[model samples]
Target: MASSTASLISLQSRPSMAVARISTAKPVQGRSFLSFGLRAIPSRRLRVSCAAKTETVNKVCEIVKKQLALAPDVAVTGESKFSALGADSLDTVEIVMGLEEEFDISVEEDSAQNIATVQDAADLIEKLVEQKQKA
Candidate 1:
């Protein structure tokens, strides 16, 4: 009975390797321990009603035209492709940067790379704006 009790005590005294592995990962400086992989959503929210979505699309169209230096005669519709609008890769990058600045939202690299048309960008911007508002 004493030998069995001693073995149980020894087992309880040993630290868990799984716990050690978890504790080895240091938390990022200036962030709370519970905030791992959690991004802070800004308290300031943007209006994201349907009307606001329409406005966002209009604003995006204007920004695209301005960024690409498109002639006023060129009609930019939501369906208009950026390449068809004479925007190359560099131009697209600039346009995306402009959208980020205009909308006050950060676009992930993958999302930014996938935008191909005016509608795509408008839709993405609308979604991000809504997400920001929710956050």
Candidate 2:
């Protein structure tokens, strides 16, 4: 009985070690293959659009700063949340209005409510702008 119990523990430990090795090896190999395949593809449009999105985020940061009456030294970035920057609900609404006016894009009420961070606003603005351009 003692021998069987010891053997069972060893069996469990050995399988866990093998599982760890297999899991680590699979992700490394898979990631390398995926990265190589992705690099082989030409993606000019994706690169251009990513640059444009970055510009949009920067613009959103500026607008948020201006709307909140933040001091020049107060840093606003893509991750900056409006509430964290001392903006109340009303201030957020005004910011949305300001963004609409500046971007010349009408944000639906649902979409406006979804703008929590500068990045969220920027992404929403980009999507709205694309839709507007398409129409």
Residue 41, candidate 1: C-alpha displacement in angstroms:
49
lDDT of each: 0.74, 0.73
Q: Which candidate wins on lDDT?
A: 1
For 34-101, candidate 1 gives per-residue lDDT tens digits of: 21122223244464433336677788899999999989998998778999999999999999999999
Clashing pairs in 2: none
Residue 123, model 1: Cα distance from true site in angstroms:
0.6
Off by over 4 Å in 1: 1-52
Candidate 1 global CA lDDT score: 0.74
Which candidate achieves the best TM-score against the true structure? 2
Tens digits of per-residue lDDT for model 2 on 23-125? 1123453452211111122223332222337888988888899999999999998888999999999999999999999999999999888778888888889
lDDT of 2: 0.73
Residues forming the 10-long window of minimal summed lDDT in candidate 2: 1-10
